[model samples]
Target: MDIVNYTLKEYFDQKKSPCLSFNVFALDKEHEEDEQKWHRSDYFQVLLLQEGEVSQGIEHRNFDLLKHQISVVFPHQINALQMGDNAKGIVIQFDEVLFCSDLLKNELISYNNDLMHKLNHVALDEETFAKINHYGVQIFELFQSLSPIKKEQIRFYIKIMLLEIIEAAHQNYQGFRAPDELDYFARFKTLIEANFKSKRTVSYYKDQLQITSKKLNEICKNKTGQTALNIIHERILTEIKRLLIFSGKNHKEIAYELGFDSPSALNKFVYAKLKETPSELKQELSKIYKY
Candidate 1:
């Protein structure tokens, strides 16, 4: 299956935020059939099966998700859903900002983290099922309230539920492991994600991370098989592709949003990095999901 990545913003815009800022979808087999090809989401999402069978193929690995079992799909993975005849579930999609604390957000965004290890292909036992059911009921009640006046309250409840789910996952999967130790190059990666939009130069990131440019490049190349600058530019380029394809921003607007000094500079970056014009990239991505 071909996999295209989508970020949190893209996910919400594509799917209506039903039930307030959070959306709970009780998908049936017909809807699942209408969902075409394997795609990956950028948002932090959780799927809770209330009835029937829930299964998925993520990056070639298959999952047999029983009732009450939850699956967490992290960003940048190809996922295919196969729901059984009686399949039903509550899928909650929300921005990580809903639970954004300095600590929790950091942990979530830390690329080399084990959050998914615990969440991926997780099964809820009978005891766990009771707890998930309780939260599920609470979510339905909040959704029915339909009061924009309580947006903050809704966000709080959603965050609490997700954290509880994450903690529960951790408990079940005692063998969960942290992502492999980030090397010096990956250290530079962390800094890049932390400060990509404002500080563009290698020197800025290197200085902030207290690593020399040469060492940073060497470590990055070793860890990811790409140069530090290439890695940074690729991330920026990926975001650019997303904005162009998913949004209707004009060239100048996109240039500024991406931290480019001038439209010409943005043009140059697109040409050099992608070997295509900005318009071409946009058209390409549009074609990618024409179905």
Candidate 2:
């Protein structure tokens, strides 16, 4: 199935608010008609499922949500959600500005980076669920208000809600690193996201960050327990899968697009990483995802 993309404006017809690029609302039976399509957007999504069941597919994985469960969808992930007839929940969607803002407190900078990479679906104890639901309800109400509340105030509440849930699923985040180290790690991740196809070497990233390769490796290891090159390979592998399954491009076309010297080079890289050639991996993903 082709993935549909949405901007914040398409979520509703209301005029865009100048101060905020975030939204909080309920998911109820009324949304059933629009729930079948697979979609992607350049914003983060948090689903608080209070009742009924939801089957959510993100990228190549499927997650089932039950009562008292929360699920997260990161920016630009191709995903779909199918809710039960009586499904009810609250959804909070926000762009990167509200999430990875430079205005965030220095302490939250590391936490934000940690959250950026981990996609977690957590089931909470009754008390914790009630507390989180209260926060979501409050945010939804405030989002509908015409009062003069500043956007930062709304973001602060959202942070509280996210921190509570992150704690509930603490195992997914490998704990935080020192602020200084996380700054470098975060910058390295951003650089990789932008240039992983063209620059696959750790030294390239190290030079761009104006740091020694040894220091870059130390920071990546401290944060993720992986060497810098392994991290780069992981990102490249993920993109390769995305293109193979969804881009409808042949191996040679993908090779050229990803800056490989030849199609054979791309095939060799895939076999080295996954022990399968590009065509074999694509067929496997196609069977698993029924795409």
Candidate 3:
């Protein structure tokens, strides 16, 4: 089936804060059919599997999220998740505004380190898991309360929960560069994500960020080990793969939708990136995603 795009309103009450927490089984019951379908969402999601295993695919990268492991799915990431009968965990969903607050932006940068590589799994030791699970349990309980949930209380717990995950990730990965550099890289990524389909040039982003191309390239390289143009191309390539797998649009149609001059131009771009034509890449991706 085609991937469905889920909006926050569908799962959250607009009157309350756009943040939610639920146990895996409860979430499955709430989103019964969707839980098993390939889908993407407009809000961020963090799945903490405290016990049992949850099989899922993110952007066509398949893996089993086991106990003591956490997987984060950024906004707009294609995901297909399945929970076995024994699965137990907390599923947290919150909109981007709540997550990118000034106090938490820097703390959250580490989570994006592997965005291009699609490495969203963070392995946590027992001690760290216990601490994070505590926060998760608190958030889950707050949402379950009959009384109105104090937005501040839930947000605080969510922040602490994310901080714990960030700490665990830092322990397992290298530290990032200066805050200013990281900020620039994050801004660049945001711009690219917003305009990748219409604007694919590094120069466009550099101009938008009011930075020199050289400086922008330096920032991208420092944060992702890739040049600014390379990052843009990767984003474009990602969308291409998603369209090829989920949109079911032919090459000619996909080209027009993505702003390519023609189908052959799209073919050439795909070949340049993957050393294969779009059809060949589609076949390969279909096999990988079991489309």
Highest TM-score model number: 1
Query: What ranges in model 3 sit over 4 Å off?
Result: 13-32, 107-112, 115-119, 146-149, 173-203, 206-291
- lDDT score of residue 257 within candidate 2: 88
Error of 3 at 168 (Å): 0.5
Candidate 1 accuracy as TM-score: 0.58
- Each model's TM-score? 0.58, 0.56, 0.57
lDDT of 3 at 23: 19
As a whole number from 0 to 100, the lDDT of residue 187 in candidate 1 is 53
- Give me the displacement of residue 52 in model 1, in angstroms: 2.3
- Give per-residue CA lDDT, model 1, range 37-107, as digits (tens): 66655455677787888768765478788887888765444577888878777776664333334345456
- Least accurate stretch of 10 residues (summed lDDT) in model 3? 18-27
lDDT of 3 by residue, 139-249 (tens): 777767524444457777887787777767766744444345446776788677668889988889888889899999887654444678877887777678768876779
How many clashes in each candidate? 1, 0, 0
Error of 1 at 182 (Å): 9.3
